[model samples]
Target: MALSFDGYKLTEIINPNGHCTQIGFTNENEPDVKKRGVILFDRQIRYIEVEEHQKFKRVKVYTTKDAEPMDFDFLEDNYANFDLFLRSIYNQ
Candidate 1:
């Protein structure tokens, strides 16, 4: 999905192992509180991106229209590969 806000475009990247259906709203100003009819629904929305750098792997989540960033740590002591990490979201 794509949304135009403040002259820029926002898009959802879902299950993206580089190619897959992403789930999220691109609109940043649609007043999710009003549209969703609940305050907690706002937490369900996020802009996700995975980046690889020279030092570390990063999975970033952007919350709010201002694009405030929240970071999460994955403690994978037994996982063997990165693909397994993504697949774990399915609970299999």
Candidate 2:
């Protein structure tokens, strides 16, 4: 699905397991770049970008609420929990 708000256009992609990933882009006609992030839930999102860390390539997950590093496995669990949460809400 697609939504527009606050000068940004957002699109959500739901996998077969019901995990959601969102991509956002500016409302401008010619945007120089588009941004992507993982939306765990309401108000719980992480914006990430590719970076080089310790001579190795990685995607850094940035958050204002915590200083802990979010690795791939942790993010995987978040996605699984989100999928389960959606199922619980819909099954009810």
Candidate 3:
């Protein structure tokens, strides 16, 4: 995949793991970076993918209220639950 921020373009490929997934970002023909994270729920299950970069960031991709599989639980009540979830996954 190609990721562009501002003007710099970053390309990556999807290297799926058994459970989680990995992204190989390439720049200037060299391995620019490696982003390892978990795909907790795909669009099929929850209509969103939550990825955390181990204390760096917790982001929800392709997220929309209508696309949500069910009513938002953790976000509606305990926002901390999401943080805890990320921590647990990263620790494992």
TM-score of each: 0.31, 0.25, 0.23
Q: Name the best candidate (by lDDT).
A: 2
Runs with alpha carbons beyond 4 Å of true place in candidate 3: 1-48, 51-73
lDDT of each: 0.36, 0.39, 0.34
lDDT per residue as tens, model 1, 1-92: 22222311222223443323333223345544222111112344466666765544444545455355433223243223334434433323
Residue range 1-90, candidate 2, lDDT tens digits: 222233333333343333343433344654664654345433333455455444333334445565544332213324544344334323
Instruction: Write down the lDDT that model 2 would get.
Output: 0.39
After TM-score superposition, what is the CA distance of residue 15 in candidate 1 from its true location, in Å? 14
Candidate 2 global TM-score:
0.25
**Highest-scoring model, TM-score:** 1
RMSD to truth, every model: 12.9, 14.4, 15.5
**Which runs in model 1 stand beyond 4 Å of their true positions?**
1-43, 64-66, 73-85, 88-92
Name every residue pair that clashes in candidate 2: none
**Which model, 2 or 3, shows the larger lDDT?**
2
